[model samples]
Target: MSRRAAGVILLAISAFLTGVKYITASIYSTSSPNSGYGADSFKQWLDYVEGNLTTYSMIVLIAGIIYLILAEIDDFDKK
Candidate 1:
């Protein structure tokens, strides 16, 4: 519908994703080598995620920004 509405929706999605990322990264993570930082297993993705708070935030922000940019581009192309 409107750019404002789309922006708000994107922001909400970003916030949700970012919150999940942070919660799993911080509270759900561990410090022991047998837990979050073991020398093997796929659970390390969780630890990696925990170590990249800024990255997750940037991803969220990038999503909103990409939406904004696409909206602007569409408007420009419509001219």
Candidate 2:
């Protein structure tokens, strides 16, 4: 409803998504053969997942944090 509420929702959603991504990546790593010999490694898969999914969520998280900060600043100015 409000900017603060929206920011809180976004923050929660981003946190949830990030947590889900880690769970998914862990499951994926276990199922796949991610040997660190060449290109396929658990770290690489995690990086890929982070780039594909978590990156956007991270951006949203940052945006939400900024929004919260701005809201606090605005409220402080009003008082």
Query: Model 1 Cα displacement at 77 (Å)?
Result: 16
Clashes per model (N, Cα, C within 3 A): 0, 0
Model 1 global lDDT (CA atoms, 0 to 1): 0.65
Where in model 1 is the C-alpha error above 4 Å? 30-47, 50-79
7-50 per-residue lDDT for model 1 (tens digits): 66777877776777656655444544555444443355455765
lDDT of 2 at 20: 81
Give stretches of model 2 more than 4 Å off.
33-41
lDDT per residue (tens digit) for residues 1-79 in model 2: 7679888998998989888887876777777764444335657667757775777798889989988988898889999
Error of 1 at 32 (Å): 7.2
Q: What C-alpha lDDT do the candidate models reach, one value each?
A: 0.65, 0.79
Alpha-carbon error at 34 in model 1, in Å? 4.6
- Candidate 1 colliding pairs: none
* Pairs that clash in candidate 2: none
